[model samples]
Target: MTTVYAAASMSLDGYVSGPAEAGFDQLFDWYGNGDVEVTTADPALTMRLREPSAQVFRQLLQETGALVVGRKTFDLTDGWGGRHPIGCPVVVLTHQVPEGWPRPDAPFTFVTDGIEPAVATARQLAGDRLVGVSGGSIARQCLDAELLDEIRIDLVPVLLGGGTPFFDHLRTAPVVLDGPSPVIEGDRVTHLRYRVRR
Candidate 1:
């Protein structure tokens, strides 16, 4: 079965990014704060994570087959240099395909219709593996559409006062979630998984 999950490394105050795209160093410090090394699909970007975080990251990479992200995230990463670190196909939800995209040899798909179609496309690409929805807006849309199965939070201990939240402006408030089961404690972060209760 393919699970639709939204994952992010969020601050204790519930922000994925700080104001004006600042505070990334505080938000993503855990990615390189340890000695355990984990290489991604991109040869140039390798992560040095704590042992526990390394295991969690490896499992995520193995399980996730495709991703659905908002255009802002796509643009912010500069298309991840044409290859996302996850080494999987990416579906970009946007009003228009960005300029100079749809390049050959790039495992990127632009979905202009909406979040549902974008996720459907990702599921097709994912087969029986997991479909990961990224970016706050996209994740919120998935949640509102009842398409998300789980939420994975790499909870970092920091408060960014204000910024982009991991979850916000839900069409349906008070959405219940199951346990933060299999909680893994890592250096400066805690990996928590919550199943969306139907």
Candidate 2:
């Protein structure tokens, strides 16, 4: 079986976005370690924060065989405008395609149905490399369906108090958890890699 990796930079308090999904840009900038420090929370989780290094990120991107994301995450990414990263197959999960929505001419496709179908399709497209689960709910659903293989969390050092969470209303009874190897980038962020407990 191929690996399914999730790369994220969540707050210290466990929030993925700020109120109304406002801080996501700042968060990604932090993820890319772009020209911003984005969050201002306690640096206690420094050891778990993921640092930005295009080489490192691209190395992981090279490992990405396909992309999976929820409607919300897909919309947000589309709003950012430009090209999708990874340059692999992108499977977007949505109930209905948005009106006037401009799908990327690249290999991106929308899945209005469910995950298993998407997974099977992505698997066929993935070949030998791994597939990546991009959105929070997508990750949650994958975990719920026992489809995810590994989770690489970029635990940034910030506490936005509340926003979107990585794992919401999730029951951890099925899967197991493993290794939190550290991938420290700067003095600020650290990337923690975990193997799904199965």
**In candidate 1, which residue pairs clash?**
none
lDDT of 2 by residue, 1-198 (tens): 877877677777777788877666655554543443323122321112233544456567578787777878767656334245456777777898666555545566667779887777787778899888877788888888888888887676777778888878776654668888555464345677888887
Compute the lDDT for candidate 2.
0.69
C-alpha TM-score for every candidate = 0.98, 0.79
Poorly placed runs, candidate 2 (over 4 Å): 29-52, 79-82, 99-104
lDDT of each: 0.94, 0.69
lDDT of 1 by residue, 1-198 (tens): 689999999999999999988889987899999999999999999999999999999999999999998999999999999999999999999999999999998999999998888999999999999999999999999999999999999998989999899899999889999989999999889999999998
- Candidate 2 clash pair list: 49-189, 49-190, 49-191, 50-190, 50-191, 176-197
Off by over 4 Å in 1: none
Among the numbered candidates, top lDDT falls to: 1
Worst ten-residue run, lDDT, model 2? Answer: 40-49
Clashes of each: 0, 6
